[model samples]
Target chain A: MSEPTADLLVVEDDADVRASLERGLRLSGFAVRSAQDGPGALRAVHERVPDAVVLDLGLPGMDGVAVVSALRAMDHDVPVCVLSARDTVDDRVVGLEAGADDYVVKPFALAELVARLRALLRRGARAAPATTPELGEVLAVGPLRVDLARRTVHVGERAVDLTKREYELLVVLARNADVVLTRERLLELVWGYDFATDTNVVDVFVGYVRRKLEADGTPRLVHTVRGVGFVLREGG
Target chain B: MRRSPSDSTGAVPLSACSPARSMSLRLRVAVASALSATVVVVLAGVLASVLLAREQTERLDRSLVPGSPAVLGSFASTRADLAVTLRGPTGTVRRVSGPELPLSPVGIPTSVTVDGVDYRIRTAPGPTPGSLVTVGATEDDTRARVAERQRLVAGVGVAAVALAAGLGWLLAGRAVRPMRRLTEQAATLDDTTSAVRADGSRESEELADALSAMLARLHAEQERSTASLHAARDFAAAARHELRTPLTAMRTDLEVLRAHPDLPERDAVLDDVLRAQGRVEATLTALGQLAAGDLPDAGGGEPVGVADLLRLAAEDARRAHPELAVVVEEPGADVPESVRAALEGLRMALANAVVNAVRHGRAGSVVLGAHRGADGGVVLTVDDDGAGLPAGEREAVLGRFVRGSTAGGPGSGLGLALVAQQAARHGGGVRLEEAPGGGLRVSLALGPDRAG
Candidate 1:
């Protein structure tokens, strides 16, 4: 009708589900392209990087985790939301660890999925385009240093390698050094999740950032506040 | 009721007195050996006392008899306990020395009491025609010696019995060592241990072997149940996912219809929703059938005719798919009239196979056939001239919720699995092979035991 809000890709093995998802997303004011498997999803992304990707975790050939890993390996930096039939914690943890931004179990409400996709798209638009002039600033907390423009990190003299989500989480925590951020607050600020979800993804990502920051046996900069969330400070 | 408490209390002392009830095997063996030893020792002591008393009495009697007057006089004078006397033929005592000897039977020795002392006296023929010679001795000295010997024998018997009891206890301890070790090992057995070992005695070794065999069987049974439980869990998980996929689509379509009431292409959207709903219903039905098949059959098997099965399957195929050609091949004359099988289950399995051919295989024509198998059983086959699956996927598709690569259209993926389940229930198996002139052939072979 008017202008589509963003371009989205839906990848699922089930033909009926893929068609329904594509139609629903398009009707929700987004341009949609679809694929039925992992390799096809990758090919579609290679041809044109979508604003966001909706993926199913179980596929016939390569599966959704490998797809997410491949997308990240190619440095796409696109926001990905996974659909899983399994409601186990380990399943969500595995998908998130493979570079997925968010996940919703099957039989979820369309409204909920739409709301999460909107949040992710909004964040992607802001985070995309590394050439933005304001990104030249650097975030430093103790031995950790993050160059936002180069998308690089270093702890003292040792350069640290991190995934896209891990880097975003570290940057958010460093920007609020000495300030305790709850899990909910971090989910909203770092992952752009405005909706309430009982997910431990924030904890999982924080662990990744902590490992990389302390790889050289440096003093701990991220401290957990027990019942509270976490803080980025000079010392525990 | 009031006497019950006192009755129970009174029974406690009786139980306590019988220590054999709770005795250990080693201790019981030792006690039994000691009891037998005591019996033998006491019997031997009694026999020795009887013989000793008779021998002492005989020796006293021999000494009482005198060979001649000089010998008798000397024998009498040698011991204060002995006396010699002369008696006339009329049994009258004439002369006596020491104590008066009683006139006893001629040439016989007899025990008599004289002056409040026991004496053994014997009378023999004298040197004169009417005279008799009598010699007598007191029994006190002989009895004293015998009493001393008997006391000594009793003391020795006591020592022997004590020694026998001690030796029995020690020997029994050594003999029961292996049995005790075996008992300890058996007590410590647990689920993790698969074997029992006892190298002690023949009986203990045999007991250990039996125990190990039992443990192995139990372990195998436990593992089999565990595997089945895992299979059931995995099937549930797969069913859930299969149902959810369709439900998700249907929900999305329904939501879109509600969101946009006047949207164009509404009929198409409605059709998609209906199709997804149908898929969900089909999946649920298939899941129910699979679960039913998983349980042990309550109504056992019955005699099913070979030709009847084929003809019924052909009719079913024709009714379900009117556009497709259906044929029933005649069974061979050598084939048996009937075989034992779950009739309803076999009918359902065959119906599902026909449905698979028409829906997934896209077969225009189907053939139902039956004949005697090489194993002296029956073989039922469904041949379809449709798209056949690759060789590798044929085996996998028989499992629950697995589909063939060449399968077309939406299916519950449980048709072939149902067939496989029925085949197994009949003590047989299912195989997929190439039919003549292309297409697929499904061969279900029943075991020879099922032939009736």
Candidate 2:
């Protein structure tokens, strides 16, 4: 219909659902590519990375959570919006903890999925553009250090490779080190989402940031305040 | 077949049967009384006969005058078998009448036989100087009269024994009637009905009361089992009906897609189909978990730390809904014991509550915590900051296939039901109340023994 702003990779085991998603996304002005299973999805990304990935959690071979973990482990910064048939909290949390950016339940409107992908791409651009702008380079919060200029992170002596969304989320937390920021505040600052729609994108990114930052066995710097939000402090 | 005569009353109560097989109690008592009567009667008859015979012999001796042998001779002639004798100072004996008799100096009545005839003889001194007189009488008449009287006593004794036996049997039958009724009633007892009225001696009444109590207990057990069976059947039927809703929607969507291969609105139809599919999948998963929850465990699963459980649930809540702020309250005391349910099942139940808050209540924040309840039970709670359920609908929402009034869209409706099921399995219960922050607070309380 118009010039596609970005490319999307659709991974699903069901043939009809996959075909329909690809067709629907293409019609909605996204250059869409398709994969039937987990290995194919990985290979497709390896050949040429897409701007975004639409992953189905239930795959015939490897599970959707595994694929997400693998993508994050490879240091790929492309945002992943998960699609799952299960609507339980445990199921969703597993996917988010595996490093997915956003998730949409199965049978979601094509328009909504497309909108989420556009928002993710736009956030990526705003988080770190191709022409890196001059700004405060290093963010230090106790033993955790976030190098904004080079888009790298470290805990004490160990270096950590973070996805783009994770990096943006970490920078926000590091900037407001001692202050507790609510989920709404984080979404507005990091993803530029103004209107609330019952999405947990902020929490998911926080989970990713915490996992990567704490991977080196450093003391937890991000503390959660019951019924409030999160705080990055020294002790607890 | 050498059966006893009493066997004719085959269904008689055990109390009525005599220990001795040879004779019944009635006959034994009758025979004992008859023997006593016979002993008394025969003793009295013998005493009367002996006294009467002694008096008659004394009179005969009085009638004999020692003045002359003529007086003695007349007395002997008065009775046919009587004999009179005369003795001189020289010890000579001569018979005056009847038969000749032995002469002796001793003068006492004695029994003798003369000429093959039994006689009662008395001798005394005669009135003539230096003369002695003797008189004798027959004992045959006295013996014959005693024999006839003894036969009469024996006949009366026999009659008394028969009458006593008949009376004893009749009394025993009346005394055992209550026991016989009890036995018949007990033999026909069943589960559906139990009616025992004890109207007899105090002991028999007590026995009947005990039997009634046992039958009541049995009836209660049977009713409980039947009620549970009915509940299981109802649950199955309701589950089927719930699944059919999603299935019907899915079929319709699929049919629509097939009818319009190149329809412009294909994406919307596909979305609807997928949504229906998701509902079906969720309902199926919930049904499976519910079944697992219903199963009885051999032993309560290993204990889980309250702190760890709360933290895990908070983390999960945060991950699933990044928009909702989830916080874990620090526990006041460390719960050394684990939850009484399977770890996985408990976790599932807690996670479902958190999700319900975010998805249905649209809660922007949630707080999860655990503490010892006032009743010394472990309590796990999830408080949300969304529109809470109405006071009336709170209980109803816990039932399977029952959605909250404020539920935004389609839901499996088994989430809260699963929580309730797990609570019951652990000998616990779930409660819903308005949170202090203006939303719903779900509390799951489990007995302390659940930790085992």
Candidate 3:
């Protein structure tokens, strides 16, 4: 009855699952559009970019990972949450590596998926206006640097490319240099996920940032403190 | 008396019970040779001593019976070790030289001890008539010589025994080198090593061959079990993945219903939930059938008539789908009356094919037919005038949990997979081809060996 909070796209190969998700998301206060495969999902996005996308990893053609890669290639910063039927760490990692913002295993609680999507959309909203800050602030830790106004990163002389989630995670770590940030704190600061969940999206994004930062064999700027969390400092 | 338990528990007693078992083969061989050598040498030494003593006594006896008494008396005086005793025929000592001699029997030499001295004495016919001469010699000389020689022989015997033990040990070590090498090889045996070889004695070679054979068999058995375990694990993972999709839909539908109690189209939402539930149940049943088919055949095959099979399948399809028409085509003349096959399994496979055509293909009619295959086998076909799959997807749809792109409605993707499984079980295959009248045709072939 009320205006929808956001526009969401549901891409799943299973028609029953896709229909159920479309209806549930619509009832949960989002204008939901559904697609049955990866290419259909991309066509829908081309027609009108949604606020967030819930994509199944096991699509009939192109697959969810390929779709995410294509979306990232076109510089579409829309938030994406993957739905994976396989409960393997490798499968989830592969999706995240392909630029998925988050993931939930199949047969998941609708409430959980809804919560994750909301967090992703909120983060996307906050990141949109980050390029027009009043003052151009630069956060530097050792050789790694983040340009807040321009929304870009460089490690020494080399320009480091990063996805939206990876950039956000690195910016959070660089802003609080030399300070140990727990996994829960990082998830809140970077992913906008306030509630407790078992997702490892924070660690995955941090891995991406670290790999891009250390691409030229630069000494690691982000160090993992065993059993605690991570810290960005000049020396390990 | 009762033996103490401690006696049995001691290490010494345990080793002593079967010393040969604990001893090395080389050491055992050496000890046996040493014992035999000692026995032979000691026996030869004793015999030589006895013969030498007798020969010395006979020489002394011949001197005692000289050709005349004059020579006898002179002979006795020349040798101090020889004491000549002249005894009368009445057996009384008449004359004596050196130590006194005891009178002894005539013509026989004997050992006598006199004044704590050993002597060899002999009595024979004297030179004078009715006179007997007895020669008494101190056997101390002969005894001493024999004793000395015996000591020398004993020393030689001991040396021989030591030499025999040393030689035996060295030879036995050489003889068992192959066995020792074999033992070392066996100790290092692992999964990567395929065979063990010991090229020496025939017995060692035979042992190595047996060991290698046993290891190869174990490796094959292990590989087979590992492969089957992997197959079962993959099947379980796929089943879980298939079941989750429907379950996800059902859960979402239920949550929506519970969230909006009075929303319009509530019945339709409830129907969706029921349909999803039914899909889950059907998927589970199909998965169970697939798992059962994976197991080795359990003597289920029987002689089944080809015509009878097609008729039964068409009847079952008609009964299951009352709205659709089912037709059974007559078998060709070349086709046999009976084929060896698991009747129940074939029936199940055909039923799945029919279900696939009706549910996914949306067929109006299905024709069941049979004919003799080109490979001397029987081929059963199901032709449907429904929406058929594209040529590219027909082959991919045969795999487990794979559904064709054109699949419509809600059905488990395991129907054609079941048909494929039965085809493989019957030593044949399944093929999907375009039907004669712009429909889909599924051909299930049974191997030539199954034809009767």
* TM per candidate: 0.83, 0.42, 0.87
Chain B alone, TM-score, model 2: 0.57
TM-score of chain A of 1: 0.87
Q: Lowest summed-lDDT stretch of 10 residues in model 2 chain B?
A: B12-21
DockQ of each: 0.58, 0.01, 0.73
Model 3 lDDT per residue over A1-236, tens place: 34348999999988899888888888888889988887898899999999999999998768899999999998887999999998878888878888888999989888888887888887777767665765568888888878888888889988898877887788889888989999999989888889999877777777878888888899999999888899999987
lDDT of 2 at A103: 88
Please tell me what DockQ candidate 1 reaches: 0.58
The residue pairs that clash in candidate 3, if any, are: B119-B139
- What ranking emerges by lDDT with the best candidate at the front? 3, 1, 2
What is the TM-score (0 to 1) of candidate 1?
A: 0.83
Residue pairs with colliding backbones in model 2 are A200-B322, A200-B323, A203-B322, B66-B126, B66-B127, B67-B127, B303-B338, B304-B338, B340-B450
What is the Cα-based TM-score of model 2? 0.42
Q: Give per-residue CA lDDT, model 3, range B83-193, as digits (tens).
A: 776767686777777777776776777788888877777777887777877677776666677788778888888999999999999998888888888877876778898
Model 2 misses residue B313 by how many Å? 4.8
Expressed as tens digits, the lDDT of each residue in B159-228 for candidate 1 is 7766766777787777677666666666667789898787867887888899889999999999999998
Give the worst 10-residue stretch by lDDT in candidate 3 chain A.
A127-136
Question: Which has the greatest TM-score?
Answer: 3
Q: Which stretches of candidate 2 lie over 4 Å from their true place?
A: A1-236, B1-154, B168-233, B247-304, B311-327, B333-345, B362-366, B372-376, B385-388, B408-411, B424-428, B434-439, B447-452
Task: Look at candidate 1 and tell me the lDDT of residue B358.
Answer: 81
